[model samples]
Target: MTATAEPRVLKHQALRAQLETLLDGMSVGDPFPAERELAERYNVSRETVRQALRAVLLEGRIERRGRTTVVAQSKVVQPLMIGSYTEAALADGRSASRILVGLTQHTADAELAAALRIAPGAPIAQLERVLTTDGYRVGLETTRLPADRYPGMLDNFDHTSSLYAAIMARGIDFERTEETIDTTLPDAREAALLTVDARTPMFLLNRISYDQNDIPIEHRRSLYRGDRMTFTTTLRAG
Candidate 1:
């Protein structure tokens, strides 16, 4: 009688689990097994192994050089800011720049909806750009604005120019802003677009800026290169 074949596991998930195990047993900078060898031992496709490895890489937990994956050191914190990126860099003695990607009008997603204080599916103008300092690409920023507040905004300014500066020129003074920061790994697309290897970790910032009338004007989410930038903040007692 012929025996039934053993069930196959989802290779990516299995590989991810194994990576977590290996990481728990090692420290940052410790070398891991070669990717091809790991795939062979696990009896999985190389693509599956890569997918699993990418997830770990994104968390700043691992680094890949040549063909090997190694653990990565922790990322540092940079202070958050609620003002213009240009101002922030100038204050730190770094030159600031923006490289415009594109702009389009779209309805808000769930997350954008809450940030803009608008109903889900409300029309909004989305702008994408790279935030640079001293000619080095430091972060990627995407800003969304409610269309009703700035109709024809896309036609008026170069996105590489300061959106805040241009908006304020139109009589919308940016009164203040709130911000939050966290660490995350970039996806394959984002990694390529940001010109960073997938192994490099990133810092994510979610910020909302308001007008003088206390109306929310701009909502931005930025991803900064983990190794190059530090987010710092000064705390005050209430």
Candidate 2:
């Protein structure tokens, strides 16, 4: 005799499909029907509705608000390139803003020296900023520049403005950037700044931006809240 699918499994699958059908044509922020109503409409138990919603939540298809759920906003699309969240948010029709947290002089460590192509212990200019989209704080960006390459950067670059804008204003042409992406749990301070639970994971991205001569001009590490972004990359066959 063939093994049979359990009744619970079949019911849950049917309920999940029913919920997806109900979600059709809904606006991104539109609230999902209340659990009681969903249970009655779908002829399933409240637990069944919760089970269905769990799958959707994991897929980032919807998000839970206080006492309810809503269709999630589309994930931010990021092509692999030299860019900033400030620019990316605007491209997606969202307002981007920056808050300069700190700016100071620092000495390069072994890792920074290699990425910035500066001698270890050389003086470097460091800047930190928080990036927000429509008031939702999404990323913390920390950047360093070899002080010798961009003298007076502390005074010349407007920390509140776009970092790329300031570098270009100083006549340094930005040619390209290389980046590495990873993920990890937010630190205590990062969790507080991001208003997320301490266990919330974040996207950690490091970049080395180069000038026309292939000289590295900037080295940056940006930590992004995982809930708000979905990085996308495209690959083509050779």
Model 2, 235: alpha-carbon shift in Å? Answer: 3.1
Residue 166 lDDT in candidate 2:
74
> lDDT by residue for model 2 over 1-238, one digit each (tens)?
9979765656767787777777776888898888889889878899988778766654556765656778877555555666556776788788878888889899999988987887999999889888777776778889888988877767856665677877787787889888888998889988777766565568899889899889998889889877677787778899
Candidate 1's displacement at residue 121, Å, is: 2.2
Q: How close is candidate 1 to the true structure, as a TM-score?
A: 0.64
Error of 1 at 151 (Å): 1.6
For the record, the alpha-carbon RMSD of candidate 1 to the native fold, in angstroms, is 9.9
Look at candidate 2 and tell me the lDDT of residue 71: 88
lDDT of 1 by residue, 1-238 (tens): 9879987877697889888887898986788877788788888888998888877765557765556667765533345655677887777776778888778889998988988889999998889998777665668899889988887777868766778877887899877888877889989977866777876778888889988898899888899987557767789999
Q: Estimate the Cα RMSD of every predicted model relative to the unseen true structure.
A: 9.9, 4.4
Using TM-score, give the best candidate's number.
2
Give the clashing pairs for model 2. Answer: none
Which sections of candidate 1 miss by over 4 Å? 1-79
Query: What are the lDDT figures for the candidates, one per model?
Result: 0.79, 0.78
